[model samples]
Target: MNEDRRGLLAATAAAALAAVAGPAKAQESETPAGPPPGTPEGNPGDFDFLTGEWRIHHRWRSGPQSAEWLEFDGEATVVGILGGICSVEELRIPARNLFGMGLRLLDQERNVWQDHWVNKNSGVVAAPGEYGGFTNGVGTWSSIYDQDGVTMISQGIWDEITPTSTRWRQRISADNGATWQETWIMHWRRA
Candidate 1:
């Protein structure tokens, strides 16, 4: 190529690179906003208690009208990330050929945590997850969803925490949180 042509090409490439890098440089310098004034701060290590391998005892109901309880055994592994600001749980029931994952993320700015679940069958992350934060030593998260054209609420609680064991239970409310029916419970022992 001619000298002029080469010079023009170099300038054009430099301009293009600058266009891409300028905004990224600005973004790098900007810090994420924290919780608003008067909003409580969240503990980054809130999920640290659950980090480890666990043997799970599961008791679940088939549906809202189910009278008989089904009991099963499962295993779970919990991993803490980002200094416990985020955690993931992998639960497997080999006998039933079931696998599921739960991901919990803290929204530092909002001072709350969101819980998401992904079933192996679908391999999709459920969005707009249940939101809550740890209170004392227990964690409670809840969400509202439509069930048979009715607005139903679902809640999950983590309690009975100890060094070697913990208990989690799920409840559903058809009356807008006025009443709750326990549907599933799991006991976790360190494995």
Candidate 2:
């Protein structure tokens, strides 16, 4: 509808896609040694692979149920906090006047991560955090969200990560997890 609403929706999708896989960080520095103090037994360094500036290639549908595709570019910076147990990603998409950040925290006992997105314009959390983890090199996070009173399942995934690039996608299912419609796709490259 209006620009702010449109930007908010776009920011949500961008954050979702960005959560799947962060852009490849620079060689940068080396990690401190073992896990940080109070670190959980799970992989504390789950997000270590993505910590630096990255160039983002973004694609998504006009709406959660729309089939039309839109393309744009964005940039992101990923930083590891609490010694890799937590991470924060800042996203920028000026074409749509969107800016936001994603904060991710890991659960040591359960080994799942809770990823959250926050919009800068509204200074509010985009939605409830998605909880999940990576298995066999693929990560999938899913959560049930209520948008305007409509219940929907939101899923974000990181697929095909490599030294220089990776793929990420976001999908929503209206009926549990039965059928999913891809809402966002992102390709990240080292910047």
Q: What TM-score goes with each of the models? A: 0.76, 0.73
Please report the candidate that would top TM-score against the real structure: 1
Q: Write the residue-wise lDDT of candidate 2 on 60-123 in tens digits.
A: 8997668899999998777766667777777888888888887777766667676767788776
Instruction: Name every residue pair that clashes in candidate 2.
Output: none
- 3 Cα displacement, candidate 1 (Å): 59
* Global CA lDDT computed for model 1: 0.73
Error at 136, model 1, angstroms: 2.3
Model 1 spans > 4 angstroms off: 1-42
**Predicted structure with the largest lDDT when compared to the true one:** 1
Candidate 1's clash total is 0
The Cα local distance difference test for each model comes to 0.73, 0.70
- Ten residues in a row with the worst lDDT in model 1? 31-40
lDDT of 2 at 184: 95
